[model samples]
Target: MATTASSAVTASLTSVTLEVADPDAAHRFYSAFGVDTRIHLRASETPSSGFRGFALALTVSGPATVDAFVDAAVAAGATVLKPAAKSMWGYGGVVQAPDGTIWKVATSAKKDNGPATREIDETVLLLGVADVKATKEFYVGQGLTVARSFGGKYTEFAAGPSSPVKLALYKHRGLAKDLGVAADGSGSHRIALGGTGSAFTDPDGFVWEA
Candidate 1:
């Protein structure tokens, strides 16, 4: 029910960051998703921020559509962490970005909508937070519009219905566990999100840049 208000404290998402070893190669790979995102370059030998802690969700037409897009992503230099499959929520697959970020391309429900074009549709950068309800409340206070949400579990926020990239938060341990990694440990998540603030850190330590 929260909406972006007029106050300056209202933080709006601008771009999300992808930390990669090679910016150029990462650019080429992510270009397949058809979204322009920010990239932060790191040493080539630097290790990945293990467990992903977050995921980029691509909402498409249906199951087959998800498969086709997942295929495209694999062809674009991604590693198939999980193959396309169906779940109660819908059908989706997990892929590790060339830079080691996890992504989930899926549909909300079942249908025979076929495949999508070369370009992907709406993308949601989901952050795995320690507490979804508190994180949701924090962002709501920061002036983001909560397009849809459920307390203590998940939150989806955007500028509007057609907004291309939305910022969301899910229960962190659940997310890491879902991605097949242990839900404990600390490391720079290697992701950045643009928002209006004095550059605050979330409950789970995800940093938002002003």
Candidate 2:
């Protein structure tokens, strides 16, 4: 029998590369933020403004770890988008990196179980799409299994064991509101996704490559 698209693993995101104007400065910021190993950087002069239609989220073990990352990022020249605090979902904060990447460091646990640690539980690349349902279907057709979905609002894909980052979808304007930015942008996304399949662009213009 022919393998079904849902059962076949055609694409698996393995790495996230951000194109920045200054890789050296970005490297210094990421190193101080303690996530230098989780992402790749490249030099580019793409003219992008407002919201970039995406955000990189760091899931940590507890509130303490979230605070640790937020503090370090702020100390490394990152601008605070949202101050870390307890919310209905958990504790987290948002920061804009020097390279213009928005990062959200969060934890489901409302309280710390122990001292803060540098360990990151998961790294999620959230793409803001014009149509969540359509984009979800496009990725499903690309052989990415849906790990979780909420009607037409949001969807999360199961990352393969070897993949370094998880993928998720959110509505464009909603994502901008969540990230505390205006939903207006032009030019390149300045981001590339390294994956396990042939190169393709998603409905929202996210580029993925093998």
Candidate 3:
């Protein structure tokens, strides 16, 4: 008798691609900002304005690391949307990259346990969708497992061992408020997700590919 080998059937986010007007410049900025290894870049003149309906986040170990990232980003030409500070949950700040991508550097630790380092614990892609419940269902159909969910307000997907980025969902207006930006946005999302399945677009128009 012959037996067939089987593998776990699951969808995971393998990569993230950002479409920018100038790949070279974007490359420079990301490299200097110390996250070039986390994202891929492509050249495009896609007209985008306002919030872009998404934000990339870096989870670090402590407040010092968060400050280091924010300072590096600003030095690399990113504009400070919110200066680093301590909040009830943690210390964090928001910055807009030179290519117009919103980035949030944060940590749940209120203070540093050790010396500051450029190490990033996790990279998260937060999509601000119209309906969290519907979008969560869409990703579920694509085989993504829910790691966490909060009613119709937010949802988080479990990342596979090899996945480079984690995925999450948030209400459009709530996310905009958290990022201190306007909720209204139009044109391309300027971002893409690489998955382990066939290419498709999500309910909120987030493009994903195998």
- Best candidate (score: lDDT): 3
Question: Arrange candidates by TM-score, highest first: which order?
Answer: 3, 2, 1
User: Which lDDT tens digits does candidate 1 get at residues 17-136?
Assistant: 766677788877767755444334444444544575788778877777787778878899888878888888888888887777888888876766555554456777888887788888
Question: After TM-score superposition, what is the CA distance of residue 15 in candidate 1 from its true location, in Å?
Answer: 0.7
Taking all chains together, the TM-score of candidate 2 against the true structure is 0.94
TM-score of each: 0.82, 0.94, 0.95
Model 2: how far residue 131 lies from native, Å: 0.5
In model 1, the runs with Cα more than 4 Å from the true position are 1-10, 36-48, 160-163
lDDT of all the models against the reference? 0.71, 0.90, 0.91
- Residue-level lDDT of model 2, residues 102-189, one tens digit each, is 9999999998889999899999999999999899898888878887788678888878878778998999999999888899998889
What does each candidate score in C-alpha RMSD? 3.6, 3.7, 5.8
Where does model 3 exceed 4 Å of error?
1-9
